[model samples]
Target: MDSSPHKLYHVHGFDSRQFLEHYFSDKSDMAFGDDVLKFPIEKLRQVFAVGHINGDILIDLSIGSLIHHLYSASEFFKNIIVLKANNRCIMELKRWVDERTGAFYWGHTSTLLQEKEENSDQCQDQEAKVRSAIQHVVKYDLEKENMTDPLVLPPADCVISVWLLEVISKDQDDYIRYLRKISRLLKPGGHLMMIGALDITYYLVGKDKFQGFTYDENFVRKVLAGEGFIIDYCNVKERTAVSDLTDYKATIFIAAHKEK
Candidate 1:
């Protein structure tokens, strides 16, 4: 594949390598560490060891950690869907999913797309427009309480999301609504795994500005419990990552499954 600026996961107005290394190093360390071995990873290994996920439909929202989790899974899922509301991440997700078998990509088009354009170059321009659009205009129609339409996802056997609920809305009620939307996408008895970034603040995505939400274990458990998920496992771990020339720290992992 060509390694051009357009083809790259461009980090705007920031050092790309620093951001990647910091975040990914935190992930790599905790994932390989004994802490996760004791909690979520081990619990999930037990549940999935029985072969519940093989040949099942699995969904991942936010695509970032999902990409990492897919790499670490001992058994492969037959299908996975990665969802992103951001156009740029969606584009990158499409590229990533295409490289892996049995994966699909979905981007919420409620905010971008004034009517779809055909040209691929135009599509990139559309992503750029969406990136700029969210920076200044924070509110949109697809927000929490207003989310009335059923999410249109390809049928899947399991659903997984990470760091998605809290960032979507700051209001607790809205966060619950976000979880409910994700839960509705799953089948009964299906598995759900979430890796949460608890109690953090504003962060940058590429060159774009995004508002961040802080979550604690109590807060996250409340949201998940309200959404009908049981805490199969959770680990409170810290991550030190360089973002925008500063070291960012926060509690950074969660895993759960839907209740039977």
Candidate 2:
């Protein structure tokens, strides 16, 4: 395993299957599922269920091949555009999107969503709704001026990003630049819903260890305001599970909108 998970993910590349099974499997890592999955999933259901974030188009810039959170998004948005930094992750997403053989099972996530909505039988339909809502799965490079240059997408009405910017950014400056790129995708007054870990330095993906930019809740609000966003809602949940895969103190979710 490389010292930098980014090198493994963005440079050399690791098995997307391992990445998924390591975290999303029914018997996956406990710490990851609790703080990373369950906490964020709850926050998503809350924010999306409220009518504060209505939109026609939603863009997702998240890590790996996970679409679990999009289950809530599918209920509100008409079209969902997914942008990935690497082709491997992009292909992983497409495989699940197409329901191809060997795809990672998101049944655990579907079950969680079902439990939240109190509809035990809707697990099967959650996958179908996400598949239908995803209009495109496109590859992008954050280093580029236009991450999706030459394939200009329509500005989004809202952007949902989780567990991505922190992993890809090497420092505070990189975070700001990457945020700017993401903000560009939003139309003026569009929303940005972000989720990340507080004070997390690194996280394990299979055998690989990826470094993350550590920041507190204060910085999250500050950065969003600096980028011309108005804070609408914020939720911070303390860590409840124990795992050596990652060392995060808390999970934070912020819903903000770009100033018109």
Error of 2 at 232 (Å): 0.9
Estimate every model's Cα lDDT from 0 to 1: 0.47, 0.83
**Candidate 1 structure, TM-score to reference:** 0.59
Off by over 4 Å in 2: 1-12, 28-30, 118-124
Highest lDDT among the candidates is held by which one? 2
Residue 146 lDDT (model 1): 33
| Candidate 1 Cα RMSD after full superposition onto the native fold (Å) | 13.8
lDDT of 1 by residue, 203-257 (tens): 5444534445555778878777877777766666665433452122444455566
Report the lDDT tens digits of candidate 2 across residue range 89-170.
8899999999999888888888777778766675559889999999999888777788887799998999999888788778
Q: Model 2 clash pairs?
A: 5-210
